[model samples]
Target: MSLKIAVCIKPVPDPDYYDQITIDPVRKTITRAGIPTIINPVDKNALEAALQIKEQVGGTVTVITMAPPNGEESLREMLAMGADEACLLTDRAFGGADTLATSYTLAQGLKKLGNFDLVFTGTESADGATSQVPSQLAEWLGMAHLWNVSEIKLKEDQAEDKVQELQAKMKIENGYIEYEVKLPAVLAVSRDLNTPRFTSIMGVMKAKKKPLTVFTVNDVDVDRTLIGLDGSPTKAGAVFTPSLSRKGERLTGDLDEVVEQLLQKLRAAGINLEIKSSSQGGR
Candidate 1:
């Protein structure tokens, strides 16, 4: 029972040209034209986790992504990084999709690919950090899912070529909680999960020959009403640039007086400040 692993990935606008990114006033979406795209940073961590599992156990890793056709570039990069195969789900119908629609489409893609022992995704995409897709995708597929996973390990005493259980650490507010996850589940990994392996020259050249399949809305078993903008119930209310300018106040006073004024200003801004004497635990 060789494990079948699927890694969900996304192509996001290159961070290098972040300043060049703009919002379409009419569409209320990011204007991605003319900007380069790259694999979302944390998504590589998810891919790395999948690749590591495939290495430890007998398995095949398939990377999946839903984006415009240019997304093929991202898939090729994943192949170069050692994914056994890749799938690109692209179509005009997928435009303007919110988390729900996006996840729904991805669920359909997974369905078309057949069942897998595990599915991996980043906690969130860089462009849209809603962090909602993983859980929503799990819901659509009717599978158990976990997010913000910082670590993953195979449970001991597992049969060869088959993975039935996993030990994972989920990041919490102050600490992390661990779990023994049963297989056939989804995991949204965090950046700390693993460092992505670098692509070798040979791997890059070999990626060109690996299987890269493309699917459109017509290719998968999906309800037309449940996939793109029309399927997305939520829409952006507005898009605007926030002002980063801040006003500064000058304090004309001696050192101690200025410090007191500064503390008062901080308190006035709703910041709590506490000071204690040396005897009361003050340094």
Candidate 2:
């Protein structure tokens, strides 16, 4: 049976420019106005996993994301990595969304896209690292979900054009646990699951001809009260950089006296220091 797989991806600020990222003082939100972006690293792993499955079985891999219009670049890159199609959900209304609102918007986008046998996502985004979207999306879709997946094995169904089950390994602290997951499921994959392939000249050329569609809040059927910042329950409390200044002291005295003063200062600061008896060694 042929499968229809969807991989959810995100565009995050480039790590090289992390030092330049800042928070908006008034809104208490990440200020990403001028920062360059890249497809979140672990999200590439999720796309790779989806592509592998499509190769093992006859299937179509579609990449989806909720980001700014510039997110089209990330989607094009995914198409070069072998996704059959790409979808971008973008709008000013989507601004300042937390994981819950983001997931809800993505779920609505998926519904409009069509039914899928599976959906894959990275364990977390590089910037947020909340590890919440996959489970939250599953809840919105009312589907089974799993996270930290490092391995997968697909099981064929007797019925034509359908998938019923598969085995997946969830990476844990000490080891990994294997589970038989039923289809039409959401999986948040870890980076260790697979190594992503580089985009080749041919793949890049092919990607140029692939369909990359953009949708906005008006296109998808979504609740106005549950699709953006207004729907986000969590908000940033306080955002500020801590002071990194240091204090120093210099002792002015003869060598022995200076050493004693240093020792006393160290002791005053709760440091444990013991001087051995010098008479035994005649120091």
**Residue 260's lDDT in candidate 2:** 93
Among all windows of ten consecutive residues in candidate 2, which has the lowest summed lDDT?
274-283
Residue 164's lDDT in candidate 1: 80
Q: What is the lDDT of residue 249 in candidate 1?
A: 66
Model 1 agreement with the true structure over 75-137: per-residue lDDT tens digits: 999999999999999999989899999999999999999998899999988877899999999
Model 2 TM-score is 0.83
Those runs of model 2 whose alpha carbons end farther than 4 Å from true positions after fitting are: 22-34, 158-162, 243-283
Q: What C-alpha lDDT values do all the predictions have?
A: 0.90, 0.91
Task: Score every model by TM-score.
Answer: 0.86, 0.83
Per candidate, the number of residue pairs that clash is: 0, 0
The TM-score leader among the candidates is 1
User: What's the alpha carbon RMSD for model 1?
Assistant: 3.3
